[model samples]
Target: MDLSNIDLSKFDGLAFIWLDIETITGTGVYDTLSSPDTWFVHKNPDVCEDFICSDLKNKQIFLITSGSLGHKIIKSIHHLPQLHSVYIYCQDIARHTPLASEFKKIRSVCNKTQSLISQLAIDVAHICVNIGDQHSRLNKHKQALVWYERAFEKIKQHNGLTKNEFVNALKSKINISTLECQRFQQHRQQLGEGMNEVKYQHELLRQLLDVPTPLSSTEKDDKHIAATIKKIDEWERKNIQQIKTVAERVRQQLQKQINEINKVNKVKHDFRLINDELRQRQSEDDYVEADLQQWLERLQQLKHQLETTTISDTSQIDVQITDDIDWSSMVKLVESDVSKTWVRTREISMVESL
Candidate 1:
């Protein structure tokens, strides 16, 4: 008799157990008929009497019987732990009875368990791949590499993956990191030498001063022009000195600012790279908080520059009105023909009177 020949569905919500009786031949099967109370004794006579006398507590038992006693066994089968267990035991009973139906049922359950295990393995591997891919996409190359390596290791350790799968995943991560490293290097190289803001401003101012303005005709006056030229020379000399002094001060200030900015930028770049690495290893919220603090400090320094630098109205040369005009008037004397004619007529009248 094959124990695996029983149908589990027949006992879907029912419970039953097997009773093995051994003879000198080591195998014996018999059929019996009895009531529910009597069937318990026939199935487990030694334990049934004690079991009925005792409280039974929370304990459950199943009793399977053949022929006429089967109904009684079925009645007490409800106390069994579960229907599945009862059905399993029933199949064992069928071993002595030997049937084709029972074996088919056991095969079905085995197939179901195998399917579940296969699906679980696939799901676990897929989850690992997704986690690795997400980290990789986040620009955290090192961290992504770590996740990929870990996933590959986990896949190999638990999922029984082939060596090729592990190697492929590792190579993919390495390739991503190599590309990212190259890109970062290129970006750094492109930043090159920065502009000097103070020197640029001074050069621009010098060009403005070098531009020539046309001189007016009135400016060519001897005395007025001499005084004007002296004043212009003095003003140029003074302003030139002032411009030089201011240029030096501004140059120093700009150099200082550039140095500070460079220092801060270097620190910021290092911190940013560190943060990028950390983000791969940590959570997004943590990285954002740290980055914000660095930005805030930089913003405060920019604000201080804005507050300290004073904007002034530009001074322009004002050509004095007196310098633009000559005040002295010149008059030219002319002899008129009417005055000469009148003098001649007066002389003729005086001669006629004589």
Candidate 2:
């Protein structure tokens, strides 16, 4: 198809896109669509209702796929209030015309083309415009500006776009951003008014509570009035005290959590430091743990191997483990800086060779 013949200049204020539903297999739409304006919405009954029928704004979507979809899926599009139009593009147009009519908002029914270079080129520019239109319709002017900027960038990158196109796109961006700022200010004003109303209501309640009630002057009513006043005062004081106690308890609990978090963080910090120090040590290969029984057993094994070997006494390395030792002196030696903490162990193959 010829791109020069395809006039996407008409996309100025319109929101529309093309979708190839044949590419959409299984339950959900193919998420790989390069354009944000177009989507490959698939049919899944068990999926969230919002994903199927919600989030779409005013736009025309062309489903470029052959064959009929499920009756339920076709009917589901009709429920979307934001859709301006839907177009079905099938290989055999006449065959699906009757089925296409069953769906609402379907404006045009057309045939699919073999080639799509021109269509792709048109989409590169118009997709952003369509997104902007949809955002504007939804009263999301801030989001619209984002799409407008993206459109501007697309135009900027394209070698064929003229200066007029650049200006128009920039103008669209400014207009949308301005409108969003205005809407934001109006929302802020509305919130302020709402807050003021609440304050007024609170003040009115305070005044009503503070106002003294009219009481009977008779002696019999005096005692009853005094008792009622005392009860109310007592209840008010207890309620106030309870609130303070609860607030203090909540603060204390929060502090405990904060302290625990700090302790954990400190431990993590120290562990990382120790690991870094260990990694920096060049003699890490020679590292060993001090164990008396293990060392003695290894020495005994070496002595047994020596006894079995047929070698000259001076040529062999001799290792010994005696049964008798001064326990207190050995303990003192270990406790002092004189005891060896690490010992090197030769490979088992070396011992066997001996």
RMSD after CA superposition, every candidate: 45.7, 39.5
**TM-score against native, each model:** 0.21, 0.28
**Model 2 per-residue lDDT tens digits across residues 178-291:** 778688889989999999999999997776445333642244346745765665566557767976997788778656655655555555565565556556652455345544
Per residue, candidate 1 scores C-alpha lDDT tens digits across 48-157 of: 43453353323223333332233333334333333122222222343422321432222111123233233333333443344456555666565556545544554454
Question: Least lDDT summed over 10 consecutive residues: which range in candidate 1?
Answer: 345-354
Model 2, runs deviating above 4 Å: 1-65, 70-72, 82-85, 98-104, 113-142, 150-354
lDDT of 2 at 269: 69
Off by over 4 Å in 1: 1-121, 163-170, 178-354
User: Which prediction has the highest TM-score against the true structure?
Assistant: 2
Report the Cα lDDT for residue 147, model 1.
Answer: 45
Query: Number of clashing residue pairs in every model?
Result: 6, 0
